[model samples]
Target: MDIWKNIIIDKHFWAFYYYCKRLGDKIWFQKLDDNRANLYLIKNGK
Candidate 1:
């Protein structure tokens, strides 16, 4: 019901996946960025 879930499930939504030479590095970077954004949301009590 949330916006994130809607985006994930929407037929109009298209997820783009990239192929990186170093998958571990990309995963780490993605997780770091996601965690930082989530931290901000939590701090703001979103």
Candidate 2:
């Protein structure tokens, strides 16, 4: 049971880490046009 719990936690941590990495790449590496940038800002309340 303890080993299964650890595996589940590790999976969740990696999933969240990869998700943030992808989002960071999208925000930083991709060129955002005016419309998309505006929409992102609006969506994020920034």
Candidate 3:
């Protein structure tokens, strides 16, 4: 079966989504300010 889905969303949102997918797991995101963000890896469950 094949289905088609059409939706509208922000480009930046998708960009971040793909970025996170690349990261796989263990990620901490911090929004410092508008148009800026920080991504850190959590190690040893810390």
TM-score versus the correct structure, for each prediction? 0.14, 0.33, 0.38
Q: Which regions of candidate 3 deviate over 4 angstroms? A: 1-8, 26-46
Candidate No. with top TM-score:
3
Local distance difference test scores for all models: 0.25, 0.35, 0.45
> Per-residue alpha-carbon lDDT of model 2 for 1-46, expressed as tens digits?
2322323234544554455565644332222334343111101112
TM-score of 2: 0.33
User: Which numbered prediction scores highest in lDDT against the true structure?
Assistant: 3
lDDT at 3, model 1: 33
| lDDT of model 2 at position 46 | 25
Question: Looking at model 3, which ten-residue stretch has the lowest summed lDDT?
Answer: 1-10
Off by over 4 Å in 2: 1-9, 25-46
**Tens-digit lDDT string for candidate 3 (1-46):** 2211222245654565567667767555442335556443332222
Better of 1 and 3 by lDDT: 3
Question: What's the true lDDT of residue 40 in model 2?
Answer: 17
1-46 in candidate 1: lDDT tens per residue?
Answer: 3434322232222222222222323321121232342211101111
